[model samples]
Target: TGTICTRTALLDSRATGMFMDLAFARENGLDVQLLTHPIFYNVDGTLNEMGSVCKEVEVILWIDDHSKQVVFSMIRLGKTKLIIGHTWLHHHNLEINWTTGKLTLTQCLSDC
Candidate 1:
């Protein structure tokens, strides 16, 4: 619902969807859209019965000179504030240089 001001985001290729810390989303005054059918899971291949995902929020990502809007499902994770996962990587066709620790855009959207 509102712009996210956070700059730090972890790029996780193994993750299936973009995730945002629930507390962080609230502190930033972002609107949380409740999901009708919530899905839950953990990295350990175990069912996360604690209602892992029930809401989602939209935010804008500014990369280089281009700006793109993205949606992230809310989760209660302690490791990082935000996580850009497979959904974003595939949608934007981003390339990550592990050695240099840099991200490169492989394809440009119409807005870019």
Candidate 2:
């Protein structure tokens, strides 16, 4: 779904899954897929105040020369429009230069 393209995302080591802001997705015309079961936990295992995540959207994410299709749970994010969480980080084993704010894909699995 070429609904939206964004350059900014929060790379959080603690987040369990990738996520997209519900409002942002709607505002940008991203297609939302409803989940049969909703999620209620946050990165810290606390109750999600914004409510259950009952929808998701699949989008292609581009980072430099690499691009991958990702499914993101739609939720209400306080400060960010998207989050690239632990599941994605672990799979890609990405290198992040915090000082320079750059990301590099050191090694990639064939499937990705």
Candidate 3:
């Protein structure tokens, strides 16, 4: 249970779930849990033999004065660290401004 204090995150609307770098998770000393089922995907949608995903971790997302805890599945993404995907965005009712490259939390649910 480690708190993510980094502001640098990529907002990917096309991504279905949150993802974190395996190396980063290890460096942060985050507790990674094994998934019952493995997730497989490539950046180009081509099949690659990267084995199964056996790790996941919960991270705290801090934005401005608001904060939220989110679970991220660990993967080996080259050069990319944190990626906030559609699931998290929709769950939090977040609005993204493409023009200004800004993210706004439209509504806060009770859980959030």
Candidate 4:
């Protein structure tokens, strides 16, 4: 639809136009990315290392401890909640219990 459509009956001075909608997008999916300071952490969640990660169409959950980088990539991508850090993105899929501060690991299951 270039300027406007021809079927709408309008007044002589009125105007009409068309715009792109979400339904027309090719990649009909949400971009869930995380940008953060890459840090490494041990099993006890202690400081190990630090760094930055640059990614495209990917998720990362980085915990730095002892100067080491820990990156946890996600298999499934969502269309909402794009987490961003200072300069990079750290993608981490988490299912937090609203009732409690317990952190739960998210698993990516195959649809087939």
- Return the top candidate by lDDT: 2
Q: How close is candidate 4 to the true structure, as a TM-score?
A: 0.19
Instruction: List candidate 1 stretches off by more than 4 Å.
Output: 1-4, 42-45, 97-101, 109-112
Of 1 and 4, the candidate ranking higher by TM-score: 1
- For model 2, state the Cα shift of residue 18 in Å: 0.4
Candidate 1 clash figure, as a count? 0
| Worst lDDT 10-window in candidate 3 | 45-54
Q: List the residue pairs that clash in candidate 1.
A: none
The residue-level lDDT of candidate 4 at 52 comes to: 24
Candidate 2 TM-score versus the reference:
0.88
Model 4 scores a C-alpha lDDT of 0.27
lDDT (Cα, tens digit) per residue for candidate 4, span 23-64: 212143424244364324433566533222222232223222
| Candidate 3, 1-112: lDDT as tens digits | 5444564788787988888888888888788888887666556766645545668888677886678777898887768888888887777887668898777776867776
Which whole-number lDDT from 0 to 100 does residue 75 have in model 3? Answer: 83
Per-prediction TM-score: 0.77, 0.88, 0.75, 0.19
Q: CA shift at 84, candidate 3, in angstroms?
A: 0.9
- For each candidate in turn, give its C-alpha RMSD to the true structure in angstroms: 2.9, 1.8, 3.1, 22.6
Off by over 4 Å in 3: 1-4, 41-51, 97-100
Query: How does candidate 2 score on lDDT?
Result: 0.87
